[model samples]
Target: MTSSTEPSLYAPREPVFPRRVSGPFRRLKWWIMAVTLGIYYLTPWLRWERGPSLPDQAVLVDLAHRRFYFFWIEIWPHEFYFVAGLLIMAGLGLFLFTSALGRVWCGYACPQTVWTDLFILVERWIEGDRNARVKLWKAKWNLRKWRLRMTKWIVWLLIAMATGGAWVFYFTDAPSLARDLVSFSAHPVAYGTIAVLTATTFVFGGFMREQVCIYMCPWPRIQAAMMDDDTLTVAYRDWRGEPRGKKRDGTTGDCIDCMACVNVCPMGIDIRDGQQMECITCALCIDACDDVMDRIGKPRGLIDYLALSDEPVERAGAAPKPIWKHVLRPRTILYTTLWSLVGVGLLYALFIRSDIGLTVSPVRNPTYVTQSDGSIRNIYDVRLRNQLGEARVFRLSVSSDSLLRIDLQGIPDGSDVTVPADSTHLQRVYVTAGPDDAAASTDVSDLRLWVEDLATGDRASRATTFNGKGN
Candidate 1:
């Protein structure tokens, strides 16, 4: 039933050159850039008092030691579930925010958008605005142009290198790392990481720009599915702006076909063409349109933030539902509830989590050995994890019948076993009992091992099974 002449659904890409604009959105962007960049550059230098043996950096990921330290809290390799929980909470928060307002994260908080904006600021500062830069590119080589281009590249490269260098400082003591970097005594991998990050920052922020959001990044596509009609997005009020005509001696409609919105977009997509995939919702176009409206002596917001479902009638009085209701809809409420619950649960777990861990594995080849004195013996490989920041002595004991006893190969009965902080201790342990005290011959036998901290009287236990041969 389909006609053969219908064109394909896809449309070819068109390049955009957005002109600069200044207003509230621009001011918000400036503040965000300052805050985010400041945090990224300065956080590594902040120190926290974590007693004596641990690194003092406020936040550090000590990969060499398999530890993550954030101020007073420290996490070991086995505590990766905490990290996973944080990631889940972050994902849910993104979902909730996206459901309430479209692409707010992409516009305001995304590192890609922030960095690209910074790079563009550098470009504009050195070269000029859109028109001036376009003209400069078309003009022949001259001293003025050469000087500007050289200055821009130098500044951009320095910022890129600094960005990369600041990242590696989080892994070690920031001041010490800085000294090592300057002295050329840092690890080779550290240098390699800096080089890779610097190259990526330059290439992605300077040249790729909108292409990253459009083709390379997956968020835009995922966001489309996540959004609903009620989500507030930067939209063109097509109902009012349409019948768009040039202002010739006092036009009837508000729009003057100035194309200011098109010129100011960083992604270079005409917002008038409906919500396109490339739009990051930066609100720069809102600033541009407002300026145009002010000059033409017309009411602003020919292009503004509006929900897709809320079609504006010609009459000015048709008010939609309250904005808060739209923001706190069912999907958003669900996401927020889940995010909060998980966050609280993770916090509780982290606060009460044990500082010591015990693991016991029974020998497989010979489940039990028969001693000459009519005693049954079993060998176990025990692993102890010390997650604290200081060395501690722990006593190992077995809990069972009174006739049963436990012994460590090199340690005496009831002797203290010294374990260093943030390290694991592995040892062979033997458990013996009189034949009368031994449990019945069964595939599974109940066994419990307890480790007690001698300094603080804190104790932890593990429940395992002692396998035995059939009688």
Candidate 2:
């Protein structure tokens, strides 16, 4: 049995009501939320004019066919290095931003932040501002509260559903999938994914907003490693605003302890308490405090973006260094240089990639078969990949330093093989060496198998060994 006298490990959460404030930071947050949400919810609907062989969606992840299409670019399974490079670039970019600006990604561009902001906006519209929300939370259960809560939840569910639906649309043709979804004829996986995502999004955005950032996310812990004394982050100027009081006496600091910064915090922590892991550095407190400062005829920036390296200098009544000086340090430079190198390499590879691909697999069960005409023949299974949208004929040929001849099993002596649009065709290939050729008769001979697109004249080759009768 649990003892009531022992301190409880879990503390009951006190819901935070972030009061609305207007300033530059608030406007910036609004714009960022709009852009990020717009991109997420609308990108799947954008169309591109690919040929009839491919989906018209501008961005698609065709898992069934193992293709990723982005406008003019098509990524095959073999080209997954491009995806890896992109992920590496993203990580480097995240590190660069964290070292320079401290959790700016979490504050402004994270999907969690964006969606939570959206949910909060909806709540405010239905239940009024911060004070009204607190009152509603404390008031006794009644019809008005129930109605408002239900209305807000329903809106949140709709948004969550839309979010899930948009994600699945990226995997297939959007319009067809949408029709199937509406008709209840979509795949069971689609329905299940949507249901799961909907539940998580609704819960995360609406109920567990700040808790997710504080406890669930690992970034708050990992960010400490990425930060340094020069990292610019949201901070309280305790030197200028300390020794708190209600009245502006000579001994009283600028703080006045009005609780404006605390009231505006989404995470329900006082910024004046110094930096904490829970802080996302959203800078809404800056907006709130600045408004208070303006009203009371005091200087702004009681709460602002500051670097720890500048604190002592600023406290001694000297101006801090410029923004670029903090941002262009050695660590950031290294990240930028590495990020640029990877980007350039990816671009180079994308530009130089071939339109046709060839892979040759030797059939070694019988090794080499001796022909009736005193010759040795090696058999190979050659796969020809056609990347173009239209069907094309590919010519096959073989070359070796020694005497050798190539032949395709079904095609006539000189005729080419036909491959369908954007597909791979496996063909049987035979490389023969005459009895008089010493290289093939005694040992394995190096052979180069070449394939050429008859229409585009693009060529690719694979190197294999032609086994000899003696070996």
Q: What is the lDDT of candidate 2?
A: 0.91
Write the residue-wise lDDT of candidate 1 on 63-121 in tens digits: 99888998888888888999999999999998988888899999988988899899889
TM-score of each predicted structure versus truth: 0.92, 0.97
Best by lDDT: 2
Off by over 4 Å in 2: 1-4
For residue 93, model 2's alpha carbon misses the true position, in angstroms, by 0.6
Between which residue pairs do clashes occur in model 2? none
Off by over 4 Å in 1: 1-17, 248-251, 312-317, 440-444, 467-470
lDDT of 2 by residue, 421-468 (tens): 989899999888888887557767788998888777888899898888
Candidate 1 has an lDDT of 0.84
User: Among these predicted structures, which one has the highest TM-score?
Assistant: 2
The clash tally of candidate 2 reads: 0
